[model samples]
Target: MYGVILKIINRLQRNPKRAATWQYLKFIRLNRETKPLILYPSYFSVFLILGFLMLASSKGLLSKDINEIGDSVAGLSGVLAFLWLIVTVLLQNRDLNLQYNEIKDMRAASESQAQSLESSQIFQTLEYLEVKLENISEYVRQRRNLIIEELENFSRQNRIMYNGNTMLDLVDAMDYFVVNSSDKDALEFELSNIRNDFTYQSYLRIQAIYLNIEEVVVAYEALMINVPENIKPQVTKYINAHKKSLMVDWCDKMLPYTEKLRHALMRAVVKHGIGPEANRHFLKIFAEKDG
Candidate 1:
């Protein structure tokens, strides 16, 4: 019988609702303060019954008429009902308090879950941005190498002494040759012929690459504006680290070559008086630098 009772108790404990009810009853019974509150109604009922029996025996009411007995029993029933009302009120109050605490805990857990989801979304966005930045960096690197190779090949094919010399050096040589010659028209004609042989397509490619880099930088800045303020510091730190790496690639790998090209173009415009049509593509870039 004891083993069967233990099994029943274990089963009840395994059930959530039963376990909670059992725990509450155990708490009321064991707690010093709550023990009296829960047991007082039972204690009062016991004392009232004992006192009524003693009074009936002294007055010989148990052997009196049935009408007298019924009146006494009805009076005891009313008192018991009043006591039950008080007990019911106390139990209801306790149940209400428990429900309020449960609700508070549930709300707290919900808020925590929402915050966790939002944090996850923010990090995922950062990861996506980082990936985009890496792709842009890789593209820049590849274009830089290709541009350099094309410049070297052009220099070699033209038999131009390009060792340790930049595009500006070649421009300077051409400018010197044009300025020193007495036959101005013939010199201009020769310069025009050289320009025709020059790889104009490479110039356009360099300009496109620079524009692409500028656009990417601008788009990234705009995208960052939507990042949440609370996490902006962390996001900025991560993005800035990648930006710094990109800057290094730009400065170390591409800047030198681009600068040489810019100077050469400027010399062509200022010294040689290149027409507006020829300078049209570079006008925006030059204007930005000037500003």
Candidate 2:
């Protein structure tokens, strides 16, 4: 019963709109209150006790028989009862107003918390991103030296190559040689945009890694005709093994740019030791993309 009283008090205190409601109004008709309905019996009992105390105290001026009680004393008791009822009604109204304000404040706090929760998002820590960059840097550090080896082996074959060309020059030349030349600056700007775009940067990085692999492919294929017929199979086997690394790691990333890279390889083949027909070789390797 005590717990039930507490629960009713909590409801009225937490939601004051309920305090002045019709059900509360009906309860308030007894000069009562939105004061947790469960406390009604206790409050009524207190009033009765107070009434009995006053009547007992008036016994000295009172007649022994109930019918002989003085009119003045009876009127005073009625006034006291009226005063008690009025005091209870005023106190209930003041408490209900305070509770309504408290409820408004609580609601505001809840709304702010909900907005904060909605706007929150998960973010990668700097350490996590740094670790990923370190891993990529390590792999590139190991693999790029092999590309230099392929070029050096070509110089051993009595061919003049690259003409002091850098990787950047080769890529820039490719745009002109394969795709047409008038819009180099525009293409460069667009590539910069792709690099900066977080959504596309990962794809761009994979493409760049594959492009490095393609450079080695071009160097190797360009020299296929230069090898003696007996040694050509060995060279093919060696180059195939190297190319497999690119396929395993990057074939999917390279698919979109396959034709562009192939054209670069074709230019290298004609300029070094192969003819137009050797283009079929690139087709074979690129065809393995699906597998």
Candidate that would win on TM-score? 1
- Candidate 2 lDDT for residue 60: 51
User: For residues 1-291, could you state the per-residue lDDT of candidate 1 as single tens digits?
Assistant: 999999988899789799888889887766656556567887789999999999999999989999999999999999999998998898999889999999999999999998998889778978877787776677655554554555465555546555534334334333332434355453333323224223344345444544454454554466587788877877867767775665432333444344444445444443444445556456546745754
Clashes of 1: 0
True lDDT of residue 168, candidate 1: 46
* lDDT accuracy of residue 148 in candidate 2: 42
TM-score of 1: 0.42
Query: After superposing candidate 2, which stretches have Cα over 4 Å from the reference?
Result: 1-49, 52-135, 142-168, 176-180, 183-210, 213-291
In angstroms, the error of model 1 at 81 is: 0.9
Candidate 2 is scored at a TM of 0.28
- Model 1 scores worst on lDDT over the 10 consecutive residues at 188-197
Instruction: Report the poorest 10 consecutive residues by lDDT, candidate 2.
Output: 193-202
lDDT of 2 at 48: 71
